[model samples]
Target: MKIILSTLNAKYVHHALALRYLSKSVPDARVMAFTINHTVESVCAELYKKITTDTLLGFSVYIWNVEMTLRVLARLKKVAPQLKILLGGPEVSYDPFETLTANTFVDYVIYGEGENTFKALCNANDCVSLHSIEGLAFRQDGQVIVNPPRPLIQDLDTIPSPYTSAELAAFEGKMLYYETSRGCPFTCSYCLSSTTHGVRFFSLDRVLADLRAMLDHRVGQVKFVDRTFNCSNVRTKAIVTFLIQNAAQTNFHFEIAAHLMDDALLALLKSAPTGLFQLEIGVQSTHAKTIQAIHRQTDFEKIATHVKALRQADNMHLHLDVIAGLPYEDYEAFQKTFNDVYALKPHALQLGFLKLLKGAAIRDFEGYTYCDCAPYEVLATPWLTHAQLLALKRMEDMVE
Candidate 1:
């Protein structure tokens, strides 16, 4: 069996890791993974030229984007009808019903965590009892069936490293990406990370081992995909200290909760090697009402102080984010947020429009208006009109 797992771009490194873990559980399954640059059409054309029709037996294709999945499925059906297409990740998982029912191209949709479900599907000869499979959705007997959710993977150390030493070598002296944990502790309405109510950490020993492996591969830089790297101060300190001790080899980056930082963590980060660490802090908005509405409660003063401290250290590269189209934030309010976050002088200021993803609290609110397009992103809320959304989008482009 041959399985191909892919990302829309190089940025979605975590998806590759998850698929790699799934690939390990299936014996004799040759996995071919690639990062598609732009459109699905381009990707399929390239695949058609590379892979011949005779080679598509017991093959599985997994993709992140709906359009990409559909395009690949259409081509595969015409050329190799036996190939199975499995859809997962945030883009497809957001609205599996519409994606499954509307598009006949997708054979199965893996909801929530995909590692176990993917492994099961790969190893099974017949998928009739798909309902018995946890964390999966598929069409059975002309009806769409959704299985019960699976428990989160508690033992992160049990999973093998996604990249082999040789595979990691491809990224040597280039961009490196890895994840230290699975879920997020915060409940920010606009984020998919909030779907998981709490945090889960990988084994400290396993993490250190992965770091050592990356170092051996001569990986120049590593980015941690954890939503909030500092949710556990003890774990955060341990990882930071380990990196600092081995600063000559690995330079790690993290996305953190700025307001959650205390004096102890700051002291450690302050002394860490310069150019060895980076932090991305999500300051979604500065307005109190907007913060409350979005269910993100943080002390702005504390965040400001902590950011200032990190910036003063001249060691950590800082990045801040703000969203323009929140429930209660008006244009003026958004301006204030931009100015306040920009004042921190972050290396990059990411201004994003609100996206009402599936299973998010904001999606339940009937007060918001949405765009009807391929992406199906949110347009505006009752608090902000459609025109304001256009303005914000333009502003974001200009600022970014």
Candidate 2:
């Protein structure tokens, strides 16, 4: 059986780390990554040439590229009806039945962590074997049957590091996504990570070894996909310390909770070379009520203090994020949020609109409506009107 793992990245500089993990599990699988810039006709044409009778094509879907991916697959299926297509990633994981119902050409959907499930699918010779695989969803007798969710991988070390000497060389001078952990400590209602519980970490030894490989190859930048890089102070410090001691031209980026920073961590960061570290802090809203409504835990005062401290260093890049259209946050409240975060003088301030993503807790809240499409950006709410959100979108353009 021939397996091909693919995804349309948001940009040419971005690579799909999820595809790499799945490919590692199924060593025979080939990875074909593309960017959203590619036209659907062109991508489908390229993929169609690789399909055969026994080939299985897997797509790692995201809000940014779900439509384009579906278009490409829809065309490919018309040309090769025997071709098997599998869908995974957060976009389809939560609501597999709906995805399958709408796109009958897609043969399977892996709802959760996909390594074990994907490998099982690759090894399965017939329909009976697929039914036994946990975390799998497939059509049986004209109805989508979503199997029970798979247990989270406890020994993360078992998931082989996707990086190899040759792969590292290929990834040089581009943004690479790496992960030392999975899940998040906080349950932010707007985020899909909130649906899962607890944070899982790969062994420190495993993480350091991977980082060492990237540094050795002189990769340009590595972005940690961990939901909260500072969830564990010890782990954060250890990783930071390692990066500092093994300083290189390679830059590392992490999405961290600013309030989690302490005097010791700040001091450790200050000692690192200038521009070696970049931190992105998400302060979705400054309003206490808004934060509570979203089930997000944050202390803006502490966050402000830490952000100011980090700014004072004048070494690393600091990017702050604030979301408009959050619950109970009217235009005036959002203005306060923007102004509050702006006053900190972050190197970059991102103004984002709320996205009621599928499977996110925010969808359960009443008095809110979002677009019924990919990205599902907020349309209107009791607090913010569509016109106000549009104005915010213009403001975001100017801010960028």
Best by TM-score: 2
Model 2's alpha-carbon lDDT is 0.92
Kindly list the per-residue Cα lDDT of model 1 for residues 345-378, writing each as its tens digit: 8888898877666667887777777755434466
Residue pairs in collision within model 1:
none
* Tens-digit lDDT string for candidate 2 (1-400): 7888999999988888898899899999999999999999889888888998989999999999999999999999999999999999999988998999999999999999999999998998888887899999998878898888899999999999988789999877777999999999999999999999999999999999999999999999999999999999888999999999999899999999988888889889877899899999999899989998888988999999988887888899999999998999999998999999999999999999889999888888898888889899999999999998899999999989
Q: Judged by lDDT, which candidate is best? A: 2
Q: How well does each candidate superpose onto the true structure, as a TM-score?
A: 0.90, 0.98
lDDT of 1 at 6: 47
Residue 153, candidate 1: C-alpha displacement in angstroms: 1.4
Residue 365 error for model 1, in Å? 2.4
Residue 274 C-alpha lDDT in model 1: 82
**Please, what is the whole-model Cα lDDT of each candidate in the order they appear?**
0.74, 0.92
